[model samples]
Target chain A: MKLTRYNPSTLTDFDSWFRQPFVGFPSAAQVFSDSGSNRLAADIQEDKDNYFAQFEVPGVKKEDLKVELNNQILTISAEKKQTAGDTEQTYSLSRAISVPDGVQGDAISAKLENGILTVTLPKAEHRKPKTIEIA
Target chain B: MTTNCCNPSPTQQTAEPEAAVMKPRYFVDGTQEAYEVRVELPGVPKEGVSINLEENVLTLRAKRTPSALSDWKTLHRELKGLDFLLRLRLNTQVDEEKMTAALDHGILTLKLPVKEAAKPRRIEVQ
Candidate 1:
């Protein structure tokens, strides 16, 4: 089975329909716009048994974080609050990643340490490769 | 055949180097008594963080703990392993001896108290 890469900034349905004619040309506005706050950077890795996904979420408390998996779509969300003097501000961040087949969703686990969130997805037993001997 | 002696060989050229230093995101706010600074340093541990105050400038540096995933294959990558550095020039006078700092959940918070002499004073009319 093939796995689709995680891309947070992909255009939506409405955007794709409107920008179909200008697919080859890049927009100047997008080149200079600052989208760092709206998107979270992530690193995805895989081994023989498990897949790891890591994200940076500084200044966010564990209580304010939410992780959910529905229809093979894993979503992570958090709200970061900052207070200065008398004024307080809250920033919301969210990201979604598509999980591949043969994963044990029930046994998946997540951990947050040093402002980094790591999600581990273990592969199923049948997904492991087996070697057979010929007589 | 002519030899290109002046030009360096392709093997001598070095590969692209990774970014050595990065400025971490930070916020600063000031009130009547003190100034508060918050710096975001993801993946940095307490032992790798350092703060220095000299003259009117404050410098902060943090190093992230190295990862031990050499055997894993990377499917997608966006985060880089780089050290964090930030420098700020303080305009107001602060008491360095009374300053305090704390690190929690990868966020460093610093409180620099305003000097007594620098605080605003009111005078009554004669």
Candidate 2:
């Protein structure tokens, strides 16, 4: 379904016109809306011991990904693009996570492999190894 | 013609200053020769671009000239950067050598053919 009037001169637009393309959904103008980076489908797993955050970033490179931490808030951002004459397409995704105090931001570690980005935030030393006294 | 991350502009001097959003369309057809996947990436020039098969994955990345940022008098807004990344995981039965890509008027066409053993065959009646 074409949301706009048809332009016969551009064959490229005619080729992929959907039958019922929704306005909200990403179109040629909004392809980046559903892009791997900006619209992340992530899962955050947490336990009594630690918190695990896994972000989905398909078709992204390690060099293009960025991770930042400020005031106990962690942010992850990535950008990927394809440029042509008179057209530059860019896809970007960013997410900010709130972390409780006492967790060391300096010790955070992140790795990107096979399009999935995994971030590991270890618990503080004092938070572990509690001594149980016999009553 | 250099496009900056600070500005969302296309390099075409005559083209309007409005941001250009690219939509890469594809046509996929499976046949006896192979499964053909043709992606439409328009305005891509033909030079210093490579298509390679690594561990059954088809990756397409090209380094082209920077887009023209001079089209705008003052950089007000920026949306996308200057680059392209397209990657695909191929089927085991695909013939990588037979695959080819061509760029014309911003359309990128990729032809991937199938392997002989994977093609469907009719059984002879005894």
Top lDDT hit: 1
**Model 1 lDDT tens row, B38-92:** 8899999999899888766777889998542778777667688688877776767
Query: At residue A85, what lDDT does model 2 achieve?
Result: 39
DockQ metric for all predictions: 0.38, 0.03
Error of 2 at B17 (Å): 54
TM-score of chain A of 2: 0.61
Interface RMSD of 1: 4.8
Candidate 1: misplaced stretches above 4 Å?
A1-36, A129-135, B1-19
Clashing pairs in 1: none
Q: Candidate 1: lDDT of B76?
A: 69
What are the fnat scores of the candidates, in the order listed? 0.86, 0.00
Which candidate number has the best TM-score? Answer: 1
For model 2, fnat equals 0.00
